[model samples]
Target: MKEMEQPVLSVRNLHKQYGSGCAACRDARRERLLKNYCPACGTVYACQDISFEVFGGEILGVVGESGSGKSTLMKCLYFDQEVSAGEAYLYAYQEGRQNIFAQSAQQKRYIQNHLMGKVYQNPLDGLRMNFSSLGNIGEKLIAAGHRHVGRMEARGRELLAHVNIPEYRVKEAPKSFSGGMQQRVQIAKALSNHPPLLLLDEVTTGLDLSVQASVLDLIKMIQRDFKISMVIVSHDFGVIRMLADRTMVMLDGRVIEHGLTDQVLEDPQHSYTQQLVQSLL
Candidate 1:
């Protein structure tokens, strides 16, 4: 059999816990910490033995209700939060290597600069409210050291245009735009560096159906146009069903079901996944 291509992102035996009491818990903290505790129950094990993989050119949808640790998992992947344990390997195309929990500041900076783009649920969180859309996009590009490649001002307007926002709005602050338009700006900012992996945390949340569809469509376009790997964390099954090639149903920070979108939607084996499917229907 032909060997499978290495995953763009590989997470193995991944575990994250909150409390300090349990024996297993102590061993599970990947980053050295003096203490731990179950943030919810005060018992321990906020995340337990979680594992998953994402390949290039794949849209991996992660679904679970609120507090099910959907965002936590994404946070870990994005390096927004440190993992308690397990391997989180990011294959850096620019560096030509697999980075399993990059330790050095330089490595982290390199990855942040050129290897990934992250989008969050809240536009305000990802975008700068004080700056114009052009400023927002240009600022990130400048920070990434892309100032020498092109005129930052021209590039910013081009990105705004690419996202279908009017050229006039490029000079307006994020607060001046409507929610959906603000989201478009966020998407543009995320794409500033053209990272191969895009991590989105409920990018369509709080939008109406029509708006949600449009945003999702934009994301699809980005994935296709850039051939980027995307991991979308959301509870909306309809969104996942429409946008994702494969899906992973997560509960309590563990993957309960994972397969091609059609198979999981049509023949869900896990009770949790079935419930989720039924709820969405």
Candidate 2:
């Protein structure tokens, strides 16, 4: 019998909340909060028992409106924010035996540099505005322990070119680039370490329509060429439709619907999901 392939990333029962929970919101069965907020204790539950898996060479799309916890989920996965409780396993790290959320801070930094990459909603979050485009990629390489300047520059140039950044602009700071170009540079930087998993948080949110299409196309190309698993968070169904093989819809910090992208779009089971799909039509 052929063995089932291990998932590249597995997240289970993940939870992140701002402020400690009180009796009013702590009990799962009895708690009734206002859209993931504990009115009584003033706690905001950012992610609630979130769970999902990403297999090799596939993109998993997380779609939700603002405050749905999708972005927060991404942050938790990338270790930008500490998870209140949960287990996340990555195949590339310790053969998926260790729960990443439980790892020490130093170990988490290793995972961030070598096992996974992230492109933030704001390029400023991912790239140093004052640094050149190549320097940004070099920074990730350096974090991954690369020291040879010649080799690092070669890699930086290769990734930048792969993302369609012109050779002439490699030395330019990201702040000098347009919104779309800055995102492209960020993508190049994220790919510099050749990580197995990538997390993208609304990578195309603020771009012009034409630029958004171009960035989306570039993302598709990257997934196809690199074969890296991706977890992309977006409020735009269009972006999700274009990139995701499977989709998870979040609402009030909970996953209300999950399925193949086509299936979820065609037969949405949750009321919020149905409304979201209807908005597209």
lDDT of each: 0.78, 0.93
TM-score of 2: 0.98
How do the predictions measure up, each by TM-score? 0.88, 0.98
Model 1, residue 183: distance off in Å is 1.2
lDDT of 1 by residue, 168-189 (tens): 6688999988888988998899
> Which residue runs of candidate 1 sit more than 4 Å off their true CA positions?
1-3, 23-44, 93-100
lDDT of candidate 1 at residue 146, scale 0 to 100: 74
Top model number, lDDT = 2
* Model 2 Cα lDDT, one tens digit per residue, 165-257: 999999999999999999999999988988999999999998999999999999999999999999999999888988999999999999999
